[model samples]
Target chain A: MNRFDYIRPGSVAEAVAAASEPGAAYLAGGTNLLDLMKIGVAAPDKVIDITRLPGLDRIDWLEDASVRIGAMVRNAELARNTAFSAAFPAISEALLSGASPQLRNAATVGGNLMQETRCAYFQDPLSRCNRRAPGSGCDALEGHNRSHAVLGWTPSCIATHPSDFCVPLAALGAIVEIEGPDGSREIDLAALHELPGSESAGGIALKHGEMITALRLPAEATSFAGHSRYLKLRERTSFAFALVSAAAMLSMEQGTITEARIALGAVAARPWHATDAETFLKGKKAEAEVFAEAAGIALKEASPSGDNAFKITLATRVLTRALTLAAKGTPDRVPALPASVFMSSEGATANA
Target chain B: MTLSISLSVNGESLNVPLEDTRTTLLDLLREHIGLTGTKKGCDRGQCGACTVLLDGKRINACLTLAASVDGTDVTTIEGLAQGDTLHPVQAAFIEHDGFQCGYCTTGQIMSAVGLLSEGDAGADPERIREGMSGNICRCAAYPGITAAVLDAERRQSESEGTSV
Candidate 1:
């Protein structure tokens, strides 16, 4: 890692001012940024430490019973919060299923939102990765791409977003609060991540020197509290990234679905919300056949490469199973990945 | 630019001058403070050999910048024992044979201590496995490690009960 200047800003304004410098990155939790720095993936000229900034670590319950989570709130703290877990179990399960206990203790919501893809080629400084260097090239497009994106992928890059929390947050209709050099603004959580486009042009649309301040989940999303499931299919039973995951939340009335929210991860450059599937499921009976049809609709846009063709089938099955589990209110019954997915000769572990 | 940072490690307050602001807390402990008990296996935070307690919470020391943790309380494996008496977790590890080569033992123990403090370690073996998943044992001593954590939790609670 390169030696750089460090500044511990006293307030959000001071932090934003410090981050206005060229090649300055905000440091919160340091779980992902520092690791990338050590591996030569990212080297900032200045690191603005925002962990000490006031009012960025509190979890507040709004008057409408919705929750406002500070961006700096650690993942472990959020997962262990009784009220948040009760209101949004899918979000809690997604957060807990990610990384590990020690990592969750140190990882913050803002840092997790800003994490880069776990593309091996992108991390290797010698590899040709457009995301690492604009217009350089994409090695994952033709290399070991079993973990690459099968949905919303462009020729320039096929990397998939590695976040498990963001998928559920997107499904929960959370909003992100940002503070930039100009002023403060809010954006839907689903729009916080973008698919890879030409020349690696797609990512969070934050302007330079903008920092995420908080996340707000709307009160209406709490209606899915008892009927939500987060199903993550990974190579291992624990401590592994998802190959295909689904965050499903449904509202049922008289055994019929009134509303549905479905989002996918590890299959796209961004959290792929299955708005079409959600629309099709409205007013339909919560049956396995109905769920299978909805799952098919959700994966209709998938364009998998040769190496990751199995992901389409895997994602379809996972989504169907997730919808069924959510309808039954049995989130704990979500199954693990089969041993064959990991033991197959061509399916190497994309994340280690 | 160089910075002067103060830290409270194992109840000892120390003021140190740092010339490299990018130095990690793992390097600061192993190289500068001469506390080599905290091993540096994977300096990229993937491995938990550099696990330590920062403000009573277990975190990867390798990922933490030394200058960023100014005035915070840090505890490492070297601070677990009081004089000659080993901590309960350390003693339990010995009784359960939680090692083969033991390169990851200190990290495993510190993680267990932190887990118990966080109210995670209990009679449930699955929860213990999940909680200690961060500390990877290459020797595959997971069965022994799980036993040690459960035993340590039981012993600590028993001692507390007796004192109360």
Candidate 2:
């Protein structure tokens, strides 16, 4: 880790002011930031500890029936909250599917949203990464690009966001509340992460000193609680990042899909929200064929950035499986393995 | 610049001065406080060898900054025993031979205690394995580790039942 000055701000305003400096970074859970620093990827001179900041660790049910999740709420806490989990099970599953129990206990929602990519090239300081160093050139393009992005990727960068929590949030249309030097504002979670463009390194859209305060899930988001699922394909059943993941939510009436939301992860720079597929699923019958078609529509535009053509097919299958599970109706509780594709919906050992 | 902070480690409170702000809780314990039980395996979040209870919640101490956890209670592997008596998880681990090299035992034990307190994973072996996935025993003591956690869970529940 780099030698730096630690500043614990007492309030959000104070934290914003302290982090507004050029070489300062806000510290929430420190799971990602600290690791990045250890690898010499991020070297902030000033560390603004915002863990002590007040009024940012709450889970509020607003009068409008929307739920506002404070950014500082730990991932494990939110995943275990009965009310929150019952209302938004996909989000809970996504949260539980990420990292490990120890990490989830310390990682905060805000920090999850702000986590950097897990690309080996990005983490290796010796490698040439345009995201790590602008215009330095991307070594991932020619190197082991098996895990590179297949959607919303450009020549500048092909690294995918490594956040499982944001996948369901993007599908559910969650709104992010931001606080910065210019005051507070809100944006869709889908818009929070920027896609790699010719002139962009492709990370978060937040300007300097801007911090995510809370995430709001609208009242309608809870409507799909009965038919929501997140499915992840990974090398292991636990303690692994997603190879290809999908969040599928549906509101069905008499075996017919009334509304649907789909988002794919690890295939794009951001959670690839399948708006076209979502539009195509409305009023369609809740069937495997329909789900397969919807999955096809979702990945229609996806192309292999490098040697990841298999990921395009894998991502399509993951989405189809997620939608199929969503149509089966969400289990009474989250599976023991959370979103692992190998686990049964009931989390039974017989299947394992 | 040096900073002063207070922490309650293993039921003992102490006011410690930190000369470096970048010191992690793992380093603070092993280097400053001289509690070497919490081994530093990966020195990153990837390995759970530095697992500790922060305010009764299990977290990777290597990823946790010492200054950020000021005024918080931390419990390490050294804190699990009651004088001569071992903690239920520790006892069960010994009974089941949950460790081969024993380097990851401290973290596995602490993580097990936290998992039991969380009450999410029950006596189910698969759930126990999933809950304890963070602690990587390179010796591949997973079967024994799972059995130990299951036995500990049963023992704790039985004790509670009899006490009640």
Candidate 3:
């Protein structure tokens, strides 16, 4: 808290206009912005909060069998939605696995997708990160890089994109609807994020002052059997960041794999699309051996840090487990993970 | 610029001039509103030391800007007991020895109230646990916290049965 201006806009247009103001930022859930403000990492002269914007909080079930989630809809609402839980358990699980309860309640769908990378250097004002300030040397590369990116990393930065939703969305082929000062455009979710190597030196490619309106999901019929699975391996059982994660979507008929979609997290500068894994998996039969082979193909190019080298092994196990479980249509629930992960009672509770 | 924030807190309508200069609702409630029952530990949203009910929904007041809560309703830990009578959640916490240092007790109780208010959809212990993960207690009193919630649920069920 510094003395900054706050404007609660009544309409999306008004919110966008306010956001386009000089040095203005959009505030929806306030989880990410407020956290940044407290530490002086993000200092917007004015904030245009769109939480009160009308009609942007609805989860619309379309005639096409797709769910269009308004940008302002809470993460918790989406996570607990019956349709989402049943049809997209992996996506729902990923949402449930992220952050904590209060955060999910306050975090909006758009906010979750667009949240910044959690590089310690980026969060701390004292340290330097190219993502935060281009040309400022990245302290994370030579420093505690255990949480840094192994793939798609550049000479400039190794910060991992810290969203639990985006990785699965990339696999499920989710689309983003945004309206900027220029006009509105619908882009595939993959278009929203840029790899570190190709990113512009001055700014991220998400564009300036564009307001996300809604997320459009592809119908199940469009992408056949074996929906998707968001598999995250964290240091702790819950309330911790993913060490190495994968979102797997297998397309199979009569024990023969027709297609596969695998995405990696925590180990990449962006949501790592394992097309190699998908390529290796296609034409293979549904079995533990084939899935393990695909995992190896996915991780063949992975390069890990000194401390995070173990994550390669753990990630392989995660990918294998996720593929096997997802093939059986029994993706593990994040809430009720096996008790072996909890070392103490402190690990066990929290829901409000 | 002074932002005029008005809210109904535990049935009483109160107004406060909150500038961005002030700390969040957790700070305003404890310092200005004199409702010290809500605590602020991590200042960040990571710790649930400042859990409160925002129009029946649970939120970390520390992350919530007080100036943004115009015309909204807020319920804090102090509002739980009506007069000398304790709400079942409050009583359950006390009976279960839900705290050692007790600094985070108010937040824990407030979180429990929030969970109960969430109704049947959030009645599952797993759901409740997922919801309340934001609040952290250093004393490792989660077992008591879980027991209090389950106890409160049991008492409510029993009372409902007896009346029926």
Compute each candidate's TM-score over C-alphas. 0.94, 0.98, 0.91
Ranking by lDDT: 2, 1, 3
- DockQ of every candidate: 0.58, 0.86, 0.55
Top TM-score: which candidate number? 2
- Angstrom error of the Cα, residue A23, model 1: value is 1.5
lDDT of 2 by residue, A125-232 (tens): 999999999989999999998988999899899999888999999998999999999999999998899999887888899999999999999999999999999998
RMSD of each: 4.3, 1.4, 3.7
Q: For candidate 1 chain B, which ten residues in a row score worst on lDDT?
A: B119-128
lDDT of 2 by residue, B1-164 (tens): 68999999999998999999989999999999999999999988887999999999999999999998899999999999999999999999999999999999999999999999998887777778889989899999988999999999999889888321
TM-score of chain B taken alone, every candidate: 0.96, 0.97, 0.89
Interface RMSD of each: 4.0, 0.9, 2.9
Clashing pairs in 3: A350-B129, A350-B132, A350-B133, A351-B128, A351-B129, A351-B131, A351-B132, A352-B131, A352-B132, B48-B135
Best by DockQ: 2
- Please provide, for model 3 over A141-219, each residue's C-alpha lDDT reduced to its tens digit, 9 standing for 90 to 100: 6788787776666667777888777777877778899988888888887777776654432223566679888998878
Sort the candidates on TM-score, descending order.
Answer: 2, 1, 3
> Which numbered prediction scores highest in lDDT against the true structure?
2
Clashing pairs in 1: none
DockQ of 3: 0.55
Pairwise TM-score winner, candidates 2 and 3: 2
